[model samples]
Target: MSELTTVARPYARAAFELAVENNNIKAWSEMLSFAAEVVTNPTVEVILSSTKTAQELADLLINICDDKLDKRGQNLINLMAENGRLSVLPRVVELYADLVTEHNQEIDVIVVSAYALAKKQKEELSRSLEKRLARKVNLNCSIDKSLISGMVITAGDLVIDSTASGQLNRLSDTLQS
Candidate 1:
């Protein structure tokens, strides 16, 4: 993980917990999405990294955001600005979303195969994976022709690799070893 990830971790966790406790995950997600976008803008990026005073940066942020950020959102941004870690907002938003979904007993899976999967096939795979993992599964799919055949499924820390390309690499490694 990078320094940005490290700095964003605690803020993400705190925001996620607040969202869950208040049963306002959607609202929090929306707020964070806006913050993430604003924080990545060129002007915001300059404000975050420049040697400007903390108050100056915070005012710039508030003025830029105008009506977009709520009190809670501004508070979080202020805290980050005070710490000179505003650049971490994007990472914080991403991790906050991950935490929110995890708290909701949902898992995101990335499926890689040699070809595009049909809608029926995707639905079936998602349902099967949900049953297998005992959680709601959100899926992202991609075609990787280099895989030759079979598919690779990634969910969180777990990965199931059954692609021909993976097998060939494994065979090569074994033979070399």
Candidate 2:
């Protein structure tokens, strides 16, 4: 993980706890997504990386956020500002997303294939993976033609590289050895 992600862990954990407690995971997800987007804007990104007062930066962000945050959302933003972790907003959001999904008993998987997959294909893939993994699978698909054929599926920290390119590389390595 990156330094920013390491720095953001506590904040994301706290937000996740609060969201789970209130059964407001979806709301918190949206709020964090919004916060991340706001922080990534060129103006706000510079402000966050500068020596400006936290209150000033918070005010500008709040204005840009435009009352999108409820009480919990406000608290998350304040917490980030107070802790000097304003720049970790993006990673914080990602971690929060993982927490929420895991709490909801879902496993997110990234499926990278050589070609574009249809909705039905993705759904079927999810079903197949869910049966094997024994968990509700959320499929995220991507296209990588260099794979030549097949797909690479990643869940949690595991990589199932079923793509021909990955297999060929492994075979080549084996032959070389």
Candidate 3:
């Protein structure tokens, strides 16, 4: 997966630059997302893995995407096809989305707690995180009954594990030490 990400990064950056230049990041994002879905289809996967020529693969993708892809998007397909990089479309889309998020100065945060958070609680948390992180926060909340109490917050590389289970584990480790 990491190898695919490495291979896809350059293409993603190129696509992002093109989008930025044209002020069409939204369109590019939609096109890339649609193309990724096409490449990941089970039937398409079989054809992609076969001995078809790069041109054939590229044509198949463009035809399937049809009106969803513009001239620029078609050019991207041709370029990636020529490089035998069509299989990396999904990763490319993922990286492109990350670039868009960074450009927007936004962060996606996941919060896992023993129970669902109230609307007011979620709003407060969002404001607090925005102040601390200096970016707009998009919160995704889930419940994990095993957490017992408190919650865990994850944003990019940052993680705050304040759950009762987490605390108990730490205390156990300390006593054993």
Candidate 4:
């Protein structure tokens, strides 16, 4: 995992820089995401790991990608294929998304609640988080019944555990200590 990330960082940074220069961050993000998804398909994985020529592998990906990738995107694909780094597509997409969020002064936040949150509740939570994090908040909300009640809000490395189960665990730990 760490090795893949280490190998992917430079490629991701290069892609990000090119996107910034072209003012096409969103386009690059979409392209990388699509490419990542494509690579995850079992058939595509086999072809990628096969003894096919780099050009053949790149051509297959580029064809499947269609117009989602422009010239620069195609070049990126070709470069990765030629260098035998195509396996890092998923990590590249992840890092690219992180760069985009950082560039846009936004954060992707996950909120796991005991039940569905009302639209108003989501709005309030977004507002509160934006104020606290000092960045535009992009919320991805889901329900986790195991939480019992309340929610767990996660943004990058910060996790706020306000769920009943979380509280109980904390209390148990404290008592044990």
* TM-score for each of the candidates: 0.91, 0.85, 0.96, 0.88
Best by lDDT: 3
lDDT for model 3 comes to 0.96
How many clashing pairs in candidate 3? 0
On TM-score, the candidate that comes out on top is 3
Residue ranges of candidate 3 with Cα displaced over 4 Å: none
Error of model 1, residue 58, in angstroms? 1.4
Q: Residue 104 in model 2: shift from native, Å?
A: 1.5
Model 4 lDDT tens row, 76-146: 99999999998899999998888889999999999999999999999999999999999999999999888
Candidate 2 residue pairs in clash (backbone atoms < 3 Å): none
lDDT of 1 by residue, 1-177 (tens): 677788899999988888778888888888888878888998778667878987788778877777877788788878878888777888998899889788889999999999899999999999999999999999999999988899999998889998988889899999999
Residue 120, candidate 2: Cα error in Å is: 5.9
Q: Positional deviation of 10 in candidate 2, in angstroms?
A: 0.9
Give the poorly placed runs of model 2, Cα more than 4 Å off.
Answer: 116-123
Candidates sorted on lDDT, descending: 3, 4, 1, 2
lDDT of 2: 0.85
Which candidate, 2 or 4, has the higher lDDT?
Answer: 4
**Candidate 1: Cα lDDT at 173:** 98
Mind giving the per-residue lDDT tens digits that candidate 2 earns over 124-177? 988898998888998888998988899999999889998887898999999999
The candidates, ranked best first by TM-score, are 3, 1, 4, 2
